[model samples]
Target chain A: MIRFDDVHKSFGPKKVLRGMTLEVPKGESMVIIGGSGTGKSVALKCVLGLIRPDSGTITVEGGEGRDRDAFLARFGMLFQGGALFDSLPVWQNVAFRLLRGSLKRPRDEAKAIAVEKLRRVGLKPDVADLFPAELSGGMQKRVGLARAICADPEIIFFDEPTTGLDPIMAGVINELIREIVTEMGATAMTITHDMTSVRAIADRVAMLHDGVIQWTGPVGQMDTSGDPYLDQFIHGRAEGPIEAVR
Target chain B: MTGVLTGILGGIGATVLGLLAMIGRVTIFLGQTLSHMVRPPFYPREFGSALLTIGWLSLPVVGLTAIFTGGALALQIYAGGSRFDAEAVVPQIVAIGMVRELGPVLVGLMIAARVTSSIAAEIATMKVTEQIDALVTLSTHPMKYLTVPRVLAALITVPVLVGVGDVIGILGGYQVATGQLGFNPAAYLKNTIDFLEPLDVISSLVKGAVFGVIAALMGCYSGMNSGRGAQGVGRATKSAVEAAAVMILAANFLLTGVFFSL
Candidate 1:
């Protein structure tokens, strides 16, 4: 589980996260949804310690600063843009953390792990040797997903996991994320504006607005939920209390 | 008058703050890079690429610059010596000049032009494309994974470039003296060899190392601090080259002073 308590973050004069707080339990999928610039990504980044909050206490479930390294060790991430290294082959990119760090396995074993992860993400073993530029957008996204889960981490963060995909491919990725999260019994936190991805992958949903979590509940309650912010966001309506532009 | 004075004070404060931010960023980058350097499974391919960029590719330019500089230096020294009816001093002075100052400084400047711009452009492009963030999500530290290997390669390889440049520069002097200036080849070579001291060679190599570090440091610093758009990348590349060139020249002057105080 991950917890944020009164987190405040600002970039110069723009305050992105304003006293935001939330909790995500272990062994569940929590998808954060919001309009662009509503701080969904910022919230996720703070949990990963990528961006520190000005004033807040963040911790893994039942653990504190002492468990930082251990906590970091138990997580993986898939960024919105498939950030593949142009300089490395697909297999090497997937196996980067496994083969090139203080925690290294043998090259062959690392390759096998990368191949296996690729397979799980519905890619051929042959594709592992190709560079990212040679792969299609969908294939690259799959590769990114494979690389994220390659470490077999207990907590996974997916930032807009299916934004750029067609519906069919998005559905495939959504199924894969669900399958993997359940298989590892890992806590999964995903941030996205895509509602189709929400339906397919989320066990629970949270909506961020004006730097606060405006609503959060089981996915079943999302449609009938009374919050005007939730209604405006889910229906993709423009003229609500939530302004279209910041 | 008071308002103008206050405005000047505010300008100074803003400059101080900007410098502080830049300093803070560099410190963080170096700390992370060192951490990655020590705790790596190590990427041999990346290290080799860095070596090729900082060392091998830099050689031709350094060599070209050095050779021409040596020829021009020889002519200038000869012309000055002729004013005293002592043109014979050209060979000795050319060798010492190439070994002690021009060899390292010119090679360093050449590398600053080539390697700094390349690094800054490559890294800025990576940032723009989200590749660097991908490294982070993949559990790879970008500083260790990207910056450290390049920095270490520069530190280790640029001195070799300077050494090679020194030989080529002295050869250039020989070419001009024997083929163009009507001096005997054998006598010019002998004078050059006899005039060289080990201290001169050591100082030249030391300058190479310092210049290499400065070049790489500027690239990484500017790249990481780059803004979010196309214009941002351009600015980063421009600043990286300018800073690298300035720092290299400054370091050369300081090194020369340290090696030979008045």
Candidate 2:
């Protein structure tokens, strides 16, 4: 479980998150939907401490302060671009955490876990030895997904999980994410503007607009929410509360 | 005239402030790197890889630069000494010049161009791709995983590379003087060996280590703080090499003054 209380973040003259507050309960897949530059990524980064919120408290599992190493270990992230280490082979990228630091395991054991995770993400075992550059875009996303779930994290964050993938591949990723979250019973938070992904993966939907959550409800309620911003975003209309021109 | 004076003064003031801020940031970065050296999670594998990249792979370029410079120095010294009827001094001058100044300085500059740029570009690209953030999420410190290894490798191996460069440079001078400059092989060898002092070699190595730290630190600093996108990476790489070269030259001047002023 996570909660952001009055999170306000700004970059110089640009205020990205203004008095924004939201929550994701345990074992729920919460997908945040927003148009470009609406601070969706910024909000997620704030919780992860990649970007510090100017004024706010983000509490995870009921505590505002936790050991950074231990706190980060409880969660995994799939970056927008997959963010695989190009210097490393696919297996090493998946086994990165286990190959070093406090979570280190034997090389063979870590490789085994990496292979298993790759399989879970619909990747062949042979794909484990190739470099990230050698993989297709969809394969890279799946590899990112595999790496994210490698540690069996209690929570997982997916940032634009299906961005840059074809519709069919995007659907495959969405399905994989849904299956993983359900099977692992992990709390999930994904950010994207892909309505197709939303329908496939989200248990609950929250629409971000003007640095605040404009609408939050079950996935089924998303269609009839009637909030102009949410309706405009989900419908992909050029004219509405969210103007095409900033 | 008054407006021009004000404009120039304001520009100078802003430049000075910008320089001070940069220095402050670099000092803090160095302090963080040093502190992490003593912390847990030491990464020997990364350090080893850095050694190969920064040290072993750098041999060809460093060797070529040193050899050519040494040969050129030999020819100039012979020509200059001939005018004074002191052509015999070629070996002594070449030995001192290569071992004391040219060897370390040339090697340092070469590393700046080669190793520093590579490190900056690689790290900057990694940052652009968000691999750095991934490292953080995986419970790893990016500084430990990335910066510390490269810095440590440079500190440990640049001196060794300098030593190798010095020998190769002296060989270059020997080849030119004996094979082409009409100097006797045995006599030139004896002169070079006798003219060198232990302090000269020590100073050269010390300069190598210091220059190594500067080059690698500048690379890592520029990289870690790089802006987003491809252009950001390009800028970080260019600035890193430029800063490393300037710092190496400056540090060399100060170090020379310290070592020889006595």
Candidate 3:
């Protein structure tokens, strides 16, 4: 479980997150929907301590002290671009967390786990030996997913998981994400503007606007949420309370 | 005229401030790297690969640069010495020049071009693609995982490369002096051996080590601080080589003053 309490972050003159407040309960898939540059990524990064909040508190599982290495061990992130280590083979990339530092296992065991995780993500064993550059976009996304779940982390963050994929591939990834979160019983936090992905992956939906959650409810109730910002966002209307670039 | 002068002063001030900031950042980064070098979680595999890339693989370019520079120095010394009826000084001058200055300096520059540029480009690309963030998320210290191995490898191996370059360079001069310049082979070899002091060899190796640190640090620093996108990578690579070259030459000058003048 993660909690953000009145988080405020600013980059010089540009105020990205004025006061963002949200709480994600354990074992729930919480998807944050927001337009580009709404500080969605920034908020997620704040939780990971990648970007520190100017004023406020973020606690993971009720622990306020940021023991960086130990803290990071509990969570995995799937970056928008997959962010695979290009120098490494796919298997090594998947087993990166297990190959070094505190979680290090023997090389053989790490490779085996990587292969198994690859299989879980619907990748073949043979694909493990190939480099990321050799893989297709969708395949690379799957590999990224495999890596995120390889350590069986307690929590996973998906940042634009289906951004550059085809609709079918996006659906596949969404489904995979949904299945993985359910199977692992892992707390999931995802940020995306894709309505279809929202429907497919989210157990609960939170709409972010102007650096705060404007609306949040169960997935079934997202349609009827009467908040103007949420309504404008979900309906994809150019003319609404949420400004369409003047 | 008054406004333009103020603008000029402002630009100069900004440039100076930027330079100072960069220097501060590099100093902090270097301190972190040195501290991490002695600490735990050492990645010998990364160190080994870096040694191969920065040290062993640099042999060809270093060799070529040293050999050609040595040969050219011999010809120049011979031609210049003839004016003073001292053409016999070719071997002695070439030996001192190559061992004391040319070998280390040229090899260092070659590293700046080949190794520094490559490192900056690679790491900058990694940053751009969010691989660095991924590394952090995976509970790895990016500085320890990336910078320490490279700086250590360069620190250990550049001196060895310099020693090799010195020997090869002297051989190149010997070939030119005896084979082409009509000097007696035995006399050329004897003169080279007798003229060079142990201090000259030590200074060369020391310069090589210092230059190695500058080269690797500049590359890593530029890459780590690089902005986003392809243009950022290109700029980082360019600035890394430029910084490395300038720092090597500057360090060489100070080192030469310390070794010889002091």
- The TM-score values for the models, in the order shown, are 0.92, 0.99, 0.99
In candidate 1, list every pair of residues with a backbone clash. none
lDDT string for model 3 (A1-246, tens) is: 888889999999998898889889899999999999999999988988778899998878946365667778889899999999998999999999999988999999999999999999999999999999999999999999999999999999999999999999999999999999999999999999999999999989998899888888999999887888888899899988888886
Q: How many residue pairs clash in each candidate?
A: 0, 0, 0
Q: After superposition, how far is residue A192 of candidate 1 from its true place, in Å?
A: 0.8
**DockQ comparisons of all candidates to the true complex:** 0.44, 0.89, 0.90
Write the number of the candidate with greater lDDT, choosing between 1 and 2.
2
TM-score of chain B of each: 0.93, 0.98, 0.98
Model 2 Cα lDDT, one tens digit per residue, B99-146: 889999999999999999999999999999999999989989999999
Would you list the C-alpha lDDT of every candidate in the order shown?
A: 0.85, 0.93, 0.93
**Per-residue accuracy of model 1 over B1-262 as CA lDDT, tens digit each:** 9999999999999999997887687778777777777885477778898998788888778888989988888888888999999899888988888988888888888887888888888888789877776666555667876788888898989899999999998898888888888999888998888888888899989998988888887898788778877888999999999978887888888899999885
Which one wins by lDDT: 1 or 3?
3
Q: Once superposed on the true structure, which residue ranges of model 2 sit more than 4 Å away at CA?
A: A62-66
For model 1, the docking class works out as acceptable
